[model samples]
Target chain A: MVLRRFLPALPPLLAFAGILAIWELLSLYFGLDGLPPPSVALRQVPVILTDPQSLFDIVDSLRRMAIGIVLALVFAIPVGLWMGRSRFAAAFFNPLLSVIYPVPKAALMPIIMLWLGVGDASKILVIFLGVTLPLIYHSYQGSRAVEEKLLWSAAAMGMQPPARLARIVLPAALPEILVGCRTALVLGLITMVTSEMIARQTGIGNLVFQSLEMGIYDTVYAMIVIIGALGFILDVLFERLRGWLVGWAEPAQSIIVGST
Target chain B: MIRFRQKQRSFTFERGFRLERGLALAFAIAASTAGLTAASAQTIPTIRVGWTVPAEDAKYWMMKRPQEFPNLGKKYNVEWVQFQGTAQMVQAMAAGALDCSTQGVLSLAQGAASAGLQTYIVAQHVGEKAPESFSVYWAVKDDSPIKSVKDFKGKTIGLNVLGTGIWGPLAIALKKNGIDPDKDVKLVEAAFPTQEDAIRTGRLDVGVLNQPFAARAEAKGGLRKVFAISEEIPDIVHILEACSKTFVDKNPELAALYVQDLTAGMGKALANRDETLKIVTEIFKAPVAVFDPFYFKTRASSDAPLGSADFARDPGAAANYDGIQKMFKLYYDVGMLPKQLDVKDFKHAKIFAPLKP
Candidate 1:
């Protein structure tokens, strides 16, 4: 059973090794100063992790990302649920959301910075804007698929409208909602990096650009590796949590490897 | 019940569509009339200026010492917008967000040629009239085989930005040394701060270093200066103060007043070295020691006054059209500029007229 359990991990580990091999080969073939080999880049990962300043930047970025995702969850889930249940609410908000959906949240940093200044507020707001959309989208989809019978039964059992929504629709829609949360989690990280890159204040994004500017190729690649690892680890951890929370639900018909 | 629900849904969607269309139309009309409204408002017009680095742009210093420019608040207000690069500033200008900003010749050319951003060069910002003033240094590791510019023929040289202020001079230097800049050597974009480390590690043959970075590299040891930008392009105008043509045409008096205030501010900054240094350090959030040695000081070779003359002088005079034309030609020759640009066409005669001695 232990051997079988560990077998599932082998393919991904092999894929990781294959990717590194390809990267190393490409760097060697190009022989460009800017494109350092995987080994060289990997060596700098520990240096970045050990360095207090870089560590602080990474942690600060995660902290902002966490706050933004939480704010998005608190605000988006309800609105999404409302929109899904009420045709009027959906009609009212659908056009507005559609207009906002295509706008690159990171591109709003300059205007947002003008209004909110360059501190944590602007960065967090950008992350919030980024993470909010997917959560709302996913929650809407999830709640829309919730059984009308379940909501009716809750109401028949003396549950009020709000209670019916909270108890019956929320649980029934949770699997899809969790999927949205996972997507938002990825978007939060992207928005955090992009906003920081534009602002150039401080963060992992700033550190990455700073390294590039200084011609520290290894450090730049190392940052990419670290951020990639963070995304992967977060997705895995969230996947485990999702399994724990919605284990009784039927398996999704199609597993989406990448989230929108 | 289903028929009623369908009717209600259609009604809501129709209302939503109408609302969206109405709001969009209102926004378009408001946007179209915004310029006219501002023109008639008769309030103090705010000149939105974009800046990237605090140390490089004089506008940052001028804004810091507002008391020096008497016309700052009374005649006009300066809204300083921070940008990460000149390309972004160009985009902002194109979007009508910025009225004036410091731009390198390469950016100015690219903006005019490709981006269709018409702007008037009001005054010179920074120049390399050297042996006296600070010049960008291209350095290499002390033990590296690249002894001179000629030795860079086959080696990769790192630049802060690919085709901006420094690239023009480096291209000129390489051409002068009979090295075809395009084919003979490799140029990669690297930040000034990292160039020293890159060179030391043999990752780069030559790394471009600008002020503070050069000084810091020197203090750190292990790197030797291969060439100074001034050697190739003496008296080169590195950066120019450009005001949007639309802004200039609309408010000629304001544009001229802004230039006058700018020149006066530079004069004051030059006169008060101690205070200027303090302000610079405060803006950069660095130690005064990093800047004191070369902030505005002429090289030890010349006996010029300890003032702005070394960095920027005689704002009243027309721009150094000769030097600017040289830069344009160099950029054109380098294939950096899409086409050759004449300096006379871009100069704002009226704005600089008051400042002319």
Candidate 2:
């Protein structure tokens, strides 16, 4: 049972190891100065883990990303449900969303910085802007796609509007909303790195940029590894949450076609 | 008449083919010779000079037009590399990807801060004297009641960056005024251009601005200078022309000549205003009007010494080594420099003498 539980993680672990092997080979083959290989990263592992400031920077970045995502969810869900369920709400919001959503949120940095002031508010807002649109779009689509037959049956069963929304609309929309949340999670990390670099000087971005300045390229690489590992952990945790939330939404397998 | 008619005559098919073949042979020979010359030229070591973007690399700009450095092209097959910031230039120098840069003192200190930086300053860009020296201003919004650094005890301030040309002196100046550089004031890292907006929006109490940008802010009419960085440190040179140690050690005479070449170009800018503005306008892609106040400020200062007479031309000309040490010590005290480096370890100034007018 333990082996079976562990088996699912083997491929990702092997893939990571394979990438490290390749990185080591590249560093050796190219004789790249400043770009130390995986072994150096391993050596610095103790250093990174022990430094309180470095640990704090990592935690701070993660906290900002989480806050941004939560803010997006909090703001997007109600508006998205309204837009999805009501024609007037959809008409008012959809055009505006379409116009704003396609615009790269990063380009709005100076304006965002001006609006939110500099520090975590600006950085978090940048992430929130990036995360919100997809959440709104997917949640709207998921709610809109709920079956008319179910709505009729619920109406016949004397379900009020609020009851229908809570019991019927929300649960039916969970799978697509989870998909949007997954996408936003990835975007949250990207925007977090970007916003940190632009507005504030105290995150993984600062570490990477400053390390490059100090000619500590190994530290830059090390910070990148930390970012990647954090991203991977977040992805795994998210996927588990997604599975639990929408277990009924399993994808249909493709039919085998050839001689078999 | 017969020769003219023959020259103007249309070619027959036989003659056209023969002529084409003959021309092709000549073209191939000429192309081969040109390619060979180019390949040979590549073997000549180029002095890759780095210049930070958004103007202010006046010496680098001086080299761009022959009016600046007459024989720069003759002495060195020059290539100008553009960097977004001092840190990038320092990295390039450390990697040996760049040879020289007209680096700011903060960036130069940063290069020194790095354990592996192989760069050295050959000459000063501007000596620490009023009018001629670099101008860094601490400004507040016009309506702001905060008078000085003392007023900034609990106030928020804008910095271009923590470790840059602006911050190096700003930090020291703030500390000298009895304010703890770190704890007394809240610091926000914002771009110099946008810091004006920050101050206007009441987001920042004080904004530290570098020249040209500061001039623009002053022109915008709502900000007033509270203090000047140069006033705080009268002897601090703002910028220096620096080259890699590898370049200097191997070609000592070349390095000296490089400084001389730069001085000749930059010296012209110091002596003549209108002509220099014309060139500056072109190099910066800015208008003469924008440079009017900036030029006026520079002229009023009236201490533009084209050649810095402050330090020895070369480390061998060690008559004024103490001055150099004092400069290094100032940066160290300011905490701009991370390492407690000895001046002698890096100061080999005797190799680069300023070009005499």
Candidate 3:
């Protein structure tokens, strides 16, 4: 039993080692002259980790991600739920979503920057646009999947329409909703870095860009390692949170299974 | 009567036949549009001028801002693209996207000699600096311990980027002052606009900048020049207008006109300082009061004043090929250029030899 459990973890570790070995080989022989070897890049990590500003970069990045995700959820969830339930809402928002969702929102950064003047507000807005569409679409699909029987059963118990939606539709639809959140979680983190790099003067993305501009390639790779570690941790945290939230919905596993 | 009826039917049939022919012709035209576009490309010459624009290295005189080149508009169409650095220009040239780009010799050699891109230097200039004027300065905060390049050992120095105009001469200067560029000091790269703040806040011990920025920082009152690059590499040709070989071979006349117009424009600007300042003010969208009283503002690296004979009215000082060749040899000796990049290789004798009139 111990061997089986430990054996699964070894593959991922071996994959990481393989990647490092290839990167080192390339940097030495095949890669562009300016690129630092994996060993050289990794050596700078302790230095960056000990720096107070580097710590601030992590906290700042997380804060931006939180603000952006919250804004997305607040706007997307209600509109999405309403559209799923009410035909009037769908008619109002669906056309707009179809028009805007296909456009690359990052291309609009300059016009947005003109108005917001390259600050936190502009970065957060772009991040909101980046993740919100998928959130709304998934939420709409999840709410729409709530069965007529569940709604009828709630009504039979003399429950009001709002209460029925709250108790039956939302909970039953959460499996798909959490899946949407999972995608948005990844997207929101990506947007957080990109928006900072495009406009703002701070954050890990800015640090990476500034370092590369200065020919500090080792520092660039070090920041990447930090960002990758943060992304992995955040994704795991989100996975655990989903399991905890919908554990009762699935007796055998976690998350609300979308059977409706 | 039967024959008349036959004539009316024939007329109707003829009209139908004509409509069918028209539709077939439209379809054929639509089908061969890709081929027609290829043919159309050769009939007209489009001058695509690329420049990594900075305050010191602005090419606003190109006259191709909205649509057409100012002087050669009747002969050639113009398209423009702006880049942030020579590295980007080199990348675009390698991709066969850029036709002509203005850059320094250091970057030109890097592309031509190191990367083996077929490009030739067509025009040259000493940007924002006269022969007697000090251009690129290394600056420090008010009370920093770094008095000169010798003091730069173990201290952080700010640069724009590596393997470009500023980095090449800076390496020479540091070596001349008994400092190894690789180990003696730390180098940080920051944008020119942000350097003043970085220097004032002590984020960088010394920041490399060119006028009017170097002059502007001194005017701001807490910064002082640590050393001037002109002290080491004086009269080095600052900007070289280079073109890809394909563009030169395909459109030799347009290429010559491009260089000639650019040369004439620079000569006119150098002679008429007031008109140039007016143009600069208009381009930057600032009032007259923002700039120095003279176009050639000079600053000293030490406590002494800049050695200037007020300012001579030398218009052709910037068109010195000897100066460019000297900077070329300096870069090659310092290993900024590839070992094989001869001075002759930079001089494409056949095409667009600049008239220094």
Candidate 4:
């Protein structure tokens, strides 16, 4: 029945509506001493949008993230694939990554500031470091999972060595490699915001941080909303691109891409 | 024919779609509920307070110094955090991780006004007529032509946090000197401690300085003192002892005790300047002279109650409301406060309730 189809969509919509209502109630009642209400926070959307500087901050964040992600991908994929495909390579590097991966990138910010002098390089490098481990780990797994049959067949067909790799191994691992890239991109963004918040003097993190310090919780919330919306839009766009590139693969293959 | 087939044919597609939508809906509802519940649970009974004063300087308040701070045990459960700079310390305060802290009057007023936190004046300390109060100094190479605040018009100037400390004061000074703070000068905001290196490489024309670093800079290249906020605008440099109203409301007696102990400590420190200088120097890891000139005369008044009663009786006392109110206005006129908040609304006086004074 038409009712059955409609009922399925009703819960999420109702739940979100309930959430907004509660948020409004909290803004009205449990206000943090002198902070503005949710209405004011909502109104700031247009104000932030109209302000050119807000846009600049967003663009700056994106620019930094792009540079960091690109660097991470360039370094992670080949290195990860080499390490994953070769046991000797994995043994040599795995211990190093294992030792360093769990250490918070944020804790190293001051040292980075000292060595790199608190410029964009330090920020970008921090972002790059944050993403590189996950990127390498994911790519290594993806490379390891490349079907052995396909490589054997390519070899049996007597294809040229480079051609065999290009025609067989790369394509077989393409979906998983893209998955690594997606994780790296997300990690890069997290680091971008964290790095900016912890030190540096610019970007969305700085904007939110400055607002918080000044007791402009509305602006802080507004910046957070912007960051969330930006992340959502990015995830959607990446999903669409993944679908276009690899929809023929199983839905399971696309799950990681969608989550990112 | 179509009706019969529709009834007979399995509703597989519809069922799949319904299941997917149902899962998404459930997830959304669950997530919101979980997030709200978790957030509510995280709200603890006690308030957290942070200080930029090193652990050693604050050791008197720690449990280790049981005699000095009887207030530190499980009765109050005060959480003390430490930071390296006023910028970060105040930042933590804004995040609600700190209920009270000591910072430069300029930064404190700006932060309190903007954040809507009630900033009560607990104490005020004054430094001498020096170019720096509590900041590190920036000095150019010996050959640099920048001689004073006037020469800084077309040159790069290193500053600490722009709104909080030296930035606003420096801006006010520059505007008074017929130089636009923004258009005429390139203001580079580096952390207070690192400006020395930035200056060493000829990156800045006039480097902002606080005592010991200024003294250090003078030793390095014999730099000139262009301007001091305390000098340009006297009494603009008061150390504010402030906390949020939520904190005061929850822990009135505890808050009063905090004020009492801190004021007592300030009194002791002031009376014994040379020894206090040694202690503060060790705490800050800066030279003794860095703290020497800025150290104000602390009045040993155990009877001076907390809040307005203490200030009302001694209007010109070490931490009077009228003087702090004036400094707060200075911060407002310079566009540091987000909007004009009546300074009176900020005063929450209960300092006399606990103390017999």
In order, what fnat does every candidate score? Answer: 0.07, 0.00, 0.00, 0.00
- DockQ of each candidate's interface versus the true one? 0.07, 0.01, 0.01, 0.02
Instruction: Kindly indicate the candidate among 1 and 2 with the higher lDDT.
Output: 1
In model 2, what is the error at residue A116, expressed in angstroms? 39
- Top model number, DockQ: 1
TM-score of model 4's chain A: 0.85
Which stretches of candidate 4 lie above 4 Å from their native place?
A1-136, A139-260, B1-47, B53-66, B87-91, B125-144, B271-320, B352-357
Ranking by DockQ: 1, 4, 3, 2
Between candidates 3 and 4, which one is better according to lDDT?
A: 3
Q: Give the clashing residue pairs of candidate 4, or none.
A: A215-B115, B135-B210, B137-B209, B138-B207, B306-B351
Query: Cα-based RMSD of the predictions, in order?
Result: 12.2, 26.9, 22.3, 23.3
The TM-scores, one per candidate, come to: 0.64, 0.48, 0.52, 0.48
Interface RMSD of 1: 15.8
lDDT of 4 by residue, A172-235 (tens): 5556766876777677778888887555434777566545433345777777767777877888
A1-260: candidate 1 lDDT, tens digit per residue: 99999999999999999999999999998665578999988988998799776788797788778767777877898999988899998999899999999999999987776566555777889999999988989889988997777777767889898876666666667778889999998999899889886544457886676555435578789999999999999999888867656655644354444454
The alpha-carbon deviation from the true structure for residue B184 of candidate 3, after best TM-score superposition, in angstroms, is: 2.2
Candidate 2 — which residues are off by over 4 angstroms?
A: A1-260, B1-40, B53-58, B67-70, B131-134, B176-178, B296-324
A best-first ranking of the candidates according to their TM-score comes to: 1, 3, 2, 4
Off by over 4 Å in 1: A1-129, A137-149, A154-193, A199-260, B1-43, B54-57, B302-318, B353-357
Question: Runs in model 3 with CA error above 4 Å?
Answer: A1-260, B1-43, B55-58, B64-71, B127-131, B297-319
Residue B85, candidate 2: Cα error in Å is 1.6
> What residue pairs clash in candidate 3, if any at all?
none
Residue B191 lDDT, candidate 2, scale 0-100: 61
Best by TM-score: 1
Model 3 chain A: worst 10 consecutive residues (lDDT sum) = A251-260
